[model samples]
Target chain A: MTTNILLITLVVLAIIALNTQKLRRAVVYLGVFSLISSFLYLLYGAPDVAIAEAVIGTTITTVLYLVALKKYQVFTIYFCSDPNDPNRRNLTNNSPFINNLESFLIKQEMEPQIIYSEKPLKTILTQDKFDLAICQTNQKTLIYGSVDDYQLDALEDYLLTNHGDLNIHLIRYTEGDDNEA
Target chain B: MTDNSEIITRMTGLLYPFILLFGFYIIINGHASPGGGFQGGAVLAAVFITRYLVDPNRCIQLKTLKTAEKILFVCIILYPTFFLFSTSASHTELMNLIYLIAMNFLIGLKVCSGFTIIFFRFVFYEGGIL
Candidate 1:
């Protein structure tokens, strides 16, 4: 019965680790999984392997993963929408396009920080510090990005190729305080 | 990374001697026990890791550690070939036990240094650079 419970818990933890959206949580889940596996090794009477697993898995690997995570830079994106639109509530829920973009950023090994703001595009551009500022007006999406950002070109290419039907117009600006068409 | 936390630093400091004691115990009794060089070495590596948590910028030279590890590797290889292969010595139980204990101790030190180097490299020189 004990073996059965541990096996089931191991399977559940594996699924949870795979399904977790946050990378940090996934790392933590994997640590727990290794710890339980070490216990199982002990139950199977392989004390040497169990000791090695317990030392390497439960402590060292977790620390390494966390340290690597600490080195990953965060990419901030500000998402703005017109406050008075009749379909404003729909914008609060993530659209398929937003999800796709987030996944794309994750694939590039970046942690995306998306902030939804109801402020005007001009105000957001002048007031906030952001890597990408997206404004949704009616049926069209306007993306404002700084020219100095190296990743902007790849992001623009990605959006143009994959989401051309969304009518995204990429606008480049010199700095945050000033906007030029 | 180096934040001064009273509880973590103090508790780890308190447990330092015990951890070292356990690692040495594992290495010494490895001939008759389940754990040997690698496991005890990993436990010893934990001592360095906890030391890092207490103070990250202690400035232990990795070059010296790398050199030490290479030397230990050479000794680990040569020790067995010289003693175990010799035909003149009688294969007594005590001599065999001594041989196992010496091999385990050398291997434990080698593994400890090796793991310490890998951990330090990951901590200090990982990412951003080639």
Candidate 2:
């Protein structure tokens, strides 16, 4: 009886928290929602949904938001605000490779930065946020790099797809914001 | 150094069932409402983590684990987000629910895969004698 009431109460509170202007708070609320929703699922005899809520609803979403926050400063404003705002700038516009970074990396050509890394591994490494660590393990040439989870993920395709020479092991701990392992 | 069973063995014996229960709860409740695969998988993964912690020497090989995660993560992002915009209906309620479910599933996949990877990275990567 009380469990149901408490659950409903929590859902209401989480909804309120999510509506706030601050991005971090919203992420927090979403986390709360995930936790509570899991409990609710348990109450309603839906163990499956409860587990998903706890894991997916709570953890991953928060990590994604936090990652985005750490990288982009959380955007601070809701995405829908101010269409005519001139100050907003797109950071991804300046890229030397195909289309944008994803396509450039996807097409199996070394990035311009990769070419630049020919100087000194450390010197070229300073040019961008990502750093490569090349090695020959078991005669299978490997080029590991330092990148965020997203970029690491982008690099993942190159790995599993059997890219002939590149066995990448992204060391995610190298750069800023390293909460995740 | 400390008596091994005093801390870990007891904990594993005690904690295993609850963790399993938690995972089951997440899975069964998923489709009709909030939770789903990723969340459930994560809970299941947590059990492995718990097991690994208690006994570091044991090998936990979750085969085809990464692939499943990738598929789920991709589905979560592309499917749900796309559906959010694509499905235009008069009820608006149904659309909202669909979007929410899609998003949840994506999250579930990502969580499951991520936990699995983390297991490899931290717990099991070095192989024996932690």
Q: Largest DockQ belongs to which candidate? A: 1
Clash-forming residue pairs, model 1: none
Show model 1 residue runs off by greater than 4 Å.
A74-181, B87-89
The residue-level lDDT of candidate 1 at B99 comes to: 88
> Which 10-residue span in candidate 2 chain A carries the lowest summed lDDT?
A73-82
Q: Give the CA lDDT, 0 to 100, for residue B89 in model 2.
A: 53
Candidate 2, B66: how far from true, in Å?
1.2
Q: Which stretches of candidate 2 lie above 4 Å from their native place?
A: A1-181, B1-14, B23-44, B91-95, B126-130
Query: Any idea what lDDT model 1 has?
Result: 0.85
- iRMS of candidate 1, Å: 3.3
Worst 10 residues of 1 chain A by lDDT: A172-181
